[model samples]
Target: MRMIQRRIRERGEREIPARLIGELVMEALRDLDPVAYVRFASVYRRFEDVDAFSVEIARMKEAEVPGGGDDPNRGD
Candidate 1:
C-alpha cells in the first residue's frame, strides 16, 4: 500500500511502531473489504483461540447495522 508507505514516511521516524502500521492497514482494509479487515485483524491482534475470533466477528456484525445491530426484541 502506497498510503501506508507514505504515512510511515511522513512520520519521519527512523523506527516505526508495528502497532501503528497495523492500525493503518486495518483502516485501509476496513474501507476496501470486510473479509480482508477480519483476516488482517485476526493476525494483527494475534487471536489465540476461537473465542477471540468470535468476539471480533460479533463486533463487526454489530457495527454493520444501526440500533445496536440485530436483536430478538427488535422483531426482525
Candidate 2:
C-alpha cells in the first residue's frame, strides 16, 4: 500500500497500469476479510457516478454468468 501511494505521488497524474495495480491490490487483500476487500476497492476505484459503478458491476456479473457472452445488453 505504501508502495502504491509512493508511486502515485511520484508519477503525478500519470496513472498506474490498471492490471498491475489490480494484481498488487489483490495480493495485498489476500489475507484480508471479505468486507475489507470491498472497502479497499470502493476507495481505490473512487467511483463518482452511477454509470461508471454500474459498468463495473455488470462486468462482474457477466464474468459470473454460466455462458460468458450471454449478456442481453451486450451491445452498447
Please write out the lDDT profile of model 1 over residues 19-72, one tens digit for every residue: 899999998888789889988999889999999988888887777678778666
How high is each candidate's TM-score?
A: 0.70, 0.41
**Which numbered prediction scores highest in lDDT against the true structure?**
1
Candidate 2 stretches greater than 4 Å from native: 1-22, 26-39, 69-76
lDDT of 2 by residue, 2-76 (tens): 866776577676667886677567546634444465456666777677676576556655655679858676663
Model 2 clash number: 0
lDDT over C-alpha atoms for residue 32 of model 1: 88
lDDT of 1 at 33: 94
